[model samples]
Target: MDLDEAFELVGEFGPRQKRLTAFLVLLQVFVAFQSMLIVLVGAVPEYHLDLEEIPASREVLAKHVRFASNFTSIATEWYLIKHDAYKVSLAASLYFAGLLIGNIMFGPLSDKLGRKPVYLTGIFFDVIFGYVSAFAPNYEIFAISRFFVGITNGGMSLVSFVLTQEYVGKSFWALTGSLTNLTFAVGIAIYALLGYYIREWRFLAFISNSPGLFFFLLSFMLPESPRWLYSQGRTAEAENVLQYIALGNGKERLSVKLKQCIGAVKKDDSESGVLSLVKHPVLRWRTVILMYIWSGRRKSTTAFLIFAGIACIFTMCLPENRGGFFFSPSILALCGKLTVSAAFNIIYIYTSELYPTVVRNAGLGVCSMTCRFGGILAPFVPSLKTLGPSVPFVVFGISGLSAGFLTLLLPETLNKPIAETIEDLQTSTYQMLKNKKVNQLEENS
Candidate 1:
């Protein structure tokens, strides 16, 4: 019997899995905090020039004026400069860039080193860098610190998510994944509330980064993914972990069944990597489609709607500028957010299910990397109003619709055993293609 069969014996979504899922899901809150922290810290607060401080000389015409405000941020702490727009944008962009880099580096590392260690290392450094960012003396240092924080965020987020999926049975995949994302949404809300009350950016940063320390301590309880262990031919260790889980679930007798099943398990010693994903016909198209869906559907739709909504409401919805209640851009924007948020939850679970175990993290990393491009580009989307008010929304809407239609090409993974090897994935894909062709032949006849 294989890992899936062993899971059947041990019990899926048992008390042990529930406890583990809760811990893992809680970690997502901190990730969300780090991901959205820049919105507050790098915010440009309202300020007016102190005309008295300005030198009235022809040679000093280009000099920046002294500005004063009650609000404290990277923007206001340092006087706004001529290139303030580019500098602020860079600070935000660098974090996403770090996220991109982190996904590229850590995804493969987790596949090679195992999930728990990579995740822990990520959390440790994330806390370290979070503190560094909070205390950064200059805007340059703060921006650089945020970049490293983004790197750690990418690693922790990806590994923790993959670890969550691996711990549960196929039946709980969607439910647990969606639950974790709900926590992320909650985190974003909490961050907004915190930002509202905490006027100083440094204080807010300190408070936001403080949770990582607690999460780091809690992470000690996380176990290595048994599925990953089994795929790597560490059957003895995997069985030991499963036995522990079995005991937790009060199915101690199932440990004996796992012992028997382990003897029959054949180890596949083939090496797998990111490149392997595209080397096969079955995996190549699937990878392409999944990447496109992640980049366009998951990232673009969500980012565009959220940013566009904020832009319209703030810029166009003054009391004098308000439109009809039902047909208002604000109402339409909220609906768009609701639609995309649901899609975000589903795509994460779906992507995790599509890839096989060996290259799962690597494949996810690449897809996640693509998704960051949308994030990196999202802020500038609001600036596209110079072209047209509806341009950004239309672009995102079309991309989302196209990706929604393409999802039909993906095989349904619900209630199916997770693929443990590339061979297993290929065999399943072959069977699916064969069935499709046969059905088409019958129709032609």
Candidate 2:
């Protein structure tokens, strides 16, 4: 009896498992909601500065013409000029900064602390900071609030994601993966609709942040990761959780499952620290490749939508004088966005499946922190208009393309057993692939 047997006895894709996965999928929706809410929450309405006299000549356009949104952002309250990209998008940038910090810190913490506690703590802060941002008196305070929200989002999201993947069978990861894409799409569409209906920024903030509360409440219902418990040499608790799972799953003879778990439990020889990722030999190359993907920042389903948005913006607003071209920049941009998004979704799912359980969170965290840096830079992209509108898009496009090519270097994990330890990942997977090649050659002979 081994770990694989333990997973089997628990009943893969059983009613209990599906029920839990559904709830977890629901939570992923809110996580999607929380992440994308920023795009619309501070939509600034257009406005104009008071003019004592209208400008007679076009040369005076800079003085009289003030660029503004139809709805003023909550931060601006009054008016902001077009060139002030920092003021307009700084909160989002700061939030990404917080996300970066969260990614760096939470992975190791969760590995040390167990997934549930750190995850719950993140939810607590997520719930608290979420609402607090609505009442922010100034842009600076709002930025700080949003930053903390980003931190909780990054930390909890990583841990919770691992837990979600762990609870279900490997074959069903695709189902869960589809749920991730759907929720992301749903989150974006719903937020857009909410923005259209809701006029006040603070009201929108409250409405958007309300979902965090549900997650915190649901935190009580979530089971601690049995795998994490086992890894930490806590078989009693692991057995208890397994029993609970067996009962919920309507499987008979919990004793057999317990025996399997006991047989699988051992001294955790795998290095679980964040540094272990770079220090270990096989893991080092894996980390480097992962970092490349991270830097490319997962140009997937959700991200491509963002690119499509940029394309749409340019399509409507492209200068009338540039009508000589058959296809406008915006249309081209939109197509690129769609392609990138689909590719990203595929790559990101593959990334999650590649790492073993012990260091999965850590690997994901460091990788996502790299992504946050990209996020941090992303908000500032509008500022690049000073150089040229197409400059930013080109930069991002190159980044996405490079990442896709690098992703080919990674091994496929579809339907394969997810490794539970570094040794299992480095040694077992290596041998597994080696034996597979040998068997193929023997068959050919």
Candidate 3:
């Protein structure tokens, strides 16, 4: 009984698998809170950059307050870093920068060392960074803390999702694949709900980061992956984990299934790394297309579209003196925000399906890295207030349009079994071509 066979024998997703997967999925919600907390923590209220330049008179301050009304964000409680729009955007971007770095480092590490250690290390960092950012006394300190949060969140999101999906049987692959998106939605919703009431950025950070402690404490309840252990040639440990699973699942064929899975394990000697993503014929193109379409990448059309759309709305909301609609611009902005969220959710599921299991974490890591870079660029987009409206739109619009066309090049894996090895990826194409040849011969006969 090979590992694939053992998986099939388990008879679809059972209660034990369901319980374990549910815990794994919760990791995403926590990740979302840490990463997306910037939406609240970085919210800069109305601020006057020229305050010191102007007089200290009440009339002068009042006049500048009216002048500052041109900006977006609240004036509630900005760290000293809040004086400039570009600076504020950069402060928000530091978290994403951390995310990119984290993904790059941890993806390969998990592939080398197994997922649990890498994942727990990330969660531990996520909590520490979250609190550090909350209590950071200065802007530079806050940004540094956010960078670590990004690192941990990026590592956790990529490796954890790949790990969870690896344990899930194929019967529920597509269904389970979308669970991260659901949890992310829940996390973002909670962030918005808290932001509405808390209003203070640091307080929001405190509440959000506190959950990581619970996750870290509960981490012991979960076991290291049996599949990962088997892949690394730790057959004894793998069997022990499998036996433990069997007890909860009430399946009697644990020994038989364990032997089958272990006997079939094959070790690959190739020294492939991130560069290997683009080295294989099929994987190279697959990696390219996935990066192009990944919703998080800076080149993503959704960001440009949303940016352009929001810029257009802000134009309409501009006063008649500024030559605009002057009516409330709330609904259109809300819809645009929702559209961006939906596109990202779709990308998360799509990227996971496209890559084979061996390189799944690495592939996601690269995509995640690009996405963070895009996020880094996103802050500057709002600072383009000096460039006039059409400039930002044109820049983002072209990227978005190009991404849409690029998405059409990738293979659809809606019903396909996920490839577990480079051989699987390479051969699937050959099998298709062989079938085509057979059909042509049959027509002649």
Best by lDDT: 1
lDDT by residue (1-445, candidate 1, tens digit) is 5677678778778899999999889878888889998888777755555454655552353344444556677777665344455777788888989999999888878877788999999999999999999999987898899899999998788988888889977777888888888999899999999988999989999999999999899889878998888877677878888888888899867653332222122334335667777786777888898888777622333444344345344434433336667546667666666766677777888888887777788888988888898776777877887897766766676666666667777787765667766766656655755765787799799
Compared with the true structure, the alpha-carbon lDDT of candidate 1 equals: 0.77
In lDDT terms, how accurate is model 3?
A: 0.65
Local distance difference test scores for all models = 0.77, 0.69, 0.65
For model 3, how does the per-residue alpha-carbon lDDT over 347-376 read when each residue is reduced to its tens digit? Answer: 666676676555667888887677766765
**Which 10-residue span in candidate 3 carries the lowest summed lDDT?**
67-76
TM-score against native, each model: 0.83, 0.78, 0.74
Candidate 1: worst 10 consecutive residues by lDDT?
256-265
TM-score of 1: 0.83
List CA RMSD, all candidates.
7.0, 7.3, 7.7
Count of clashing residue pairs in every prediction: 0, 11, 11
| Candidate 3 vs. true structure, TM-score | 0.74
Select the stronger candidate by TM-score from 1 and 3: 1
- Which pairs clash in model 1? none
Q: Candidate 2 residues 1-445, lDDT tens each?
A: 3344577878766777777777767777667767876677655545574566655543453456554654435534523344443565777667777788888888888877788999999989987998888888766777789889989987987787777767766666666766766676777777788878886778888888888797788778888887777666676787777777788888766664333222232455454668778887777887887776666522233345345444545554566457556456645665766665665555556666776666778887887777776655666777877897666765665666565566566676654666666666545666866765787799799
